[model samples]
Target: MITRRGFMKVLGGGLVSAVALGSYAFGIEPLARLRVARYALTPPGWSPGLKLRLVALADVHACEPWMSARRIASICERANDLGGDVTVLLGDYASGMNLVTRYVHSSEWSKALATLRAPLGVHAIMGNHDWWEDRTAQKSGGGDTFGHRALAGVGIQVYGNRAVRLEKSGFPFWLAGLEDQLALLPGRKWKRAWMGGLDDLDGTLAQVTDEAPVILLAHEPDIFPKVPSRVALTLSGHTHGGQVRFAGHSPVVPSRFGDRYAYGHIVEGDRNLIVSGGLGCSIAPIRFGVPPEIVVVDLG
Candidate 1:
């Protein structure tokens, strides 16, 4: 009784409607909760006895309702489930400190973050957004007001160009964190007189011990070349690893320029740099080919 052309039109319309709704709900509204791990890299010559897992979470702009307290809590629960040796928050904890009250005010995010307990210790380093002069007066590698206190309040050992050593089965390794390379502002000095130009990686390594494998953390992956040979593994989460890599190619990363240092694990000489695609959105909200990630590295 129905005309074939009319029926086809109706079917087409129905499919279009469904796609529209799905896009708005899933992509725009974030109607689905996604949990994924982009295991970065394992340290070469890793000790069989040492089992260190580092979870790197980065670049959660939280500029809009895309991220809420419930979402933050959900992310934390997911991180806890990963079960790692160290949980490292790479930075950009908030869109800005002012929104801290607009979104989560009760320290629930902090408390939920602390729930992520690690033996080697829960460590974090400042991100550019977290330590701007307008945000916090600290230079690169320094902790800002919201980022420093909130993470520390939750028992995360936030660092400013500092290192912490951990021993497993008598095998020692160092975790060194530097201030955000992107956070470098002109005319301000970093604390401890430690942070210098990107070329000063040799100087940075001077303070780090070569007696053991060194794991370096710099917010931007571009600074990979500056890192030293003693650093067997490095964890970074800036550029969001192109935030949307596609077609066997990533978006133009504003940070790293070299061929080997764009995204994922890069073996530069003796150093292995694992750049996490990272969690959360930044600058823009569209993520077509790239999904947010949690980087899990196995030390064993």
Candidate 2:
């Protein structure tokens, strides 16, 4: 019941809408949009008296024009203003995309992050990109990457399969951090199904001497299934909410479990995991539906 001229008009309109949406996704959302995503929960066995507020920044993928040092400083300032008891950097400080005009160096981004302040302290872990981007670490298959050293140089404690005990208002809890699950790429010399991951979940958890509720920091959420109930919470980044989500569904996720561990707070069998959407892009500078976010978790 439609005329040829009408069909042409409708097709033109659809084309225009597609172009507009693409422009917004490529230029506006990834570059300009910033948000704070908050979650409040009492994990099983969490200390009642110890109210801990944690601000998490993750997958920074620092690059020129999109995520510059000035912008990172601004993000840090916003995080500091939140007054979290502690702040955790969830890794991927290096640019992961080829579309960057200039890659923001690790030193520059780490220095900007140095401004982050919390009464307890700022902690960090390395993401897959942090390891893959560092040629030296990749070649050796097992050493501190530039991202790790840069963060350490800026006075941030970089955790590598380690746990630290801390007390808040006399209430004690342990913080465990695991190394990146995909620390080494599959090169010619190491052609295997597993990518030579450096993560040691059991070893890290074993470091906790007491029964204090532990919060685990991991770069990827793929390790969530193995997390024990002893870990009150597991915080991760890496997936970036598929970097382009829609209607609470990501068409593609970097995680081995696909959308199962893609983004937001996930609870399974008394274990809890929070996969941050993160503050930057990977593979390309484009985002839609999922905006850049700094995650804040309140626990008791």
Candidate 3:
């Protein structure tokens, strides 16, 4: 019943709509929305009278065009305004995941992050990007240690397969942090390892007493299962909420477990997982349904 003219018109309209949608998702939307995803997590064994609020920021791929140093400073100031009791910086400080469009020094970003204020102080863990071999530096035969050292110099405790006990007033809990599991891969290749070189759950949890509530920071959400129930909650970032999501669906989610532990709160047995949608982009600096976020977690 359709003539050639009508069919062409419909097809052209569909293509135009698609282009418009893509432009909004890839460019316009990313610049506009920066969400604050708040959660109240109560893992088993949380103290009855104790409450702790944690502000978590992750995957800050600082670079040009989008994630500039000035933008990083603004994000830090925005986080500080939330007035959390403690702050956790989940890693990926540079924007080298794609083509290395721009190189923002770790120290530059860390100086901005130094402005972050928290009563219990700030804690950080390295993401896979931080451990990645710098192809750009290889041209000059150098290595990358800026992410770790710069954060440390700014008083943000960088934990690699380690745990710390935070005791503020009557509320005391344990916090464990792991190095990027990918860092353990032989030659830092994109290959997988069984129990990997960087992360040591047993080693990190050894310091904590069984009675105390423990919250862990591991960069990748894929390791959510390995976490024991004794540890109350595990916080993670890496998926970026499928970077270019559309119609409430993300086409490209980087995870071995599919979208199982992709984003937001997920409960497994008695343990809990909060995977941040993250701030900034990787591979392509475009975000659709997944807006850059600062996850605020309240624990009681």
Candidate 4:
């Protein structure tokens, strides 16, 4: 038998603990931290007459109870606030990996994506996760292949080792998009990666004939070495910038090259690479040192 006074004491403690946890879960204390980075790139071919803002969002391992549509909408709302001329979703948006099937179904993605917008246009590509999760239905081509189609239906252009030029004020800016490198098996390739992982800058740039400043959108930033000197800027986000850095630059990362290239802007030679912190969680549904991100780049 328990005493009434003792029961009250235990109940009070439990209530306090529950309140603390509820606050964390509601983001009142922010269980995760998201940081937005600003970058500037000026290539020799860049048009002096044109200056534009490009917003890049990547690695949204969106699922339920975490990166829900409302949360995703909030992220986009932030991008529009940046006043970007164009918005680019750098892939990994619909990662149907792990046990996420329980939380999200294929049909729900299109609605979640409805929140995104770009004055010029929103462009996209598939990520390694999509490949890993889609193999079960690639050939049958049912709901899985529809991922690309859904994005396309929403006015987002999907590119593979191809370049799209956005013309403004008589100056054209080249935006190059590519497939996931991991999607390439020993016999398969990133299509563009046949040039050399994502690093083959010369091959990527060769497709752009105009002197227009070039911006490469490769999902993984570690490929910075292969980017051509001609490329003034490159955007990637595979590392998620550690997404959970413990101390000085997370000692362990999933990249084959290690954590050396985890996050932030990396400059190789004259070109610059910005690795987004990424949104959503992978492997698990929690983030520590890292928070989801939306990046803004000023071409000025």
lDDT of each: 0.66, 0.92, 0.81, 0.69
Off by over 4 Å in 3: 99-101, 134-144, 184-196, 246-249
RMSD of each: 5.7, 1.2, 3.4, 6.6
Error in Å for residue 200 of model 3? 0.7
Query: By TM-score, how accurate is candidate 3?
Result: 0.90
TM for every model, in the order presented, reads 0.77, 0.98, 0.90, 0.79
Instruction: Give the range of the ten consecutive residues with the poorest summed lDDT in model 2.
Output: 187-196
Candidate 2: tens digits of C-alpha lDDT, residues 1-300? 999999999999999999999999999999898999999999999887889999999999999889999999999999999979999999899999999889999889999999999999999999999999888788788879999899999899999999999989999998889999989888675554567789999999989999889999999999998898999999999988998888899999997898999899999989999999999999988889889999999997
Write the residue-wise lDDT of candidate 1 on 165-274 in tens digits: 77766888888887767564454344433433322455556676657778888877777766766677887876666655667467567574843455677776667888
For every model in order, what is the number of clashing pairs? 1, 0, 0, 4
Q: Give candidate 1's error at residue 217 in angstroms.
A: 1.0
Q: Which pairs of residues collide in model 2?
A: none
- Rank the candidate models, highest lDDT first: 2, 3, 4, 1
lDDT of 3 by residue, 160-263 (tens): 88888888677788889987866533333333333243678888888786577888999998888898988888999988988866575667788888778778
Q: How many clashes does the backbone of model 3 have?
A: 0
Instruction: Please list all clashing residue pairs in model 4, or write none if there are none.
Output: 199-226, 201-226, 201-227, 201-228
Q: Which structure among the candidates has the greatest lDDT?
A: 2
Query: Best TM-score goes to which candidate?
Result: 2
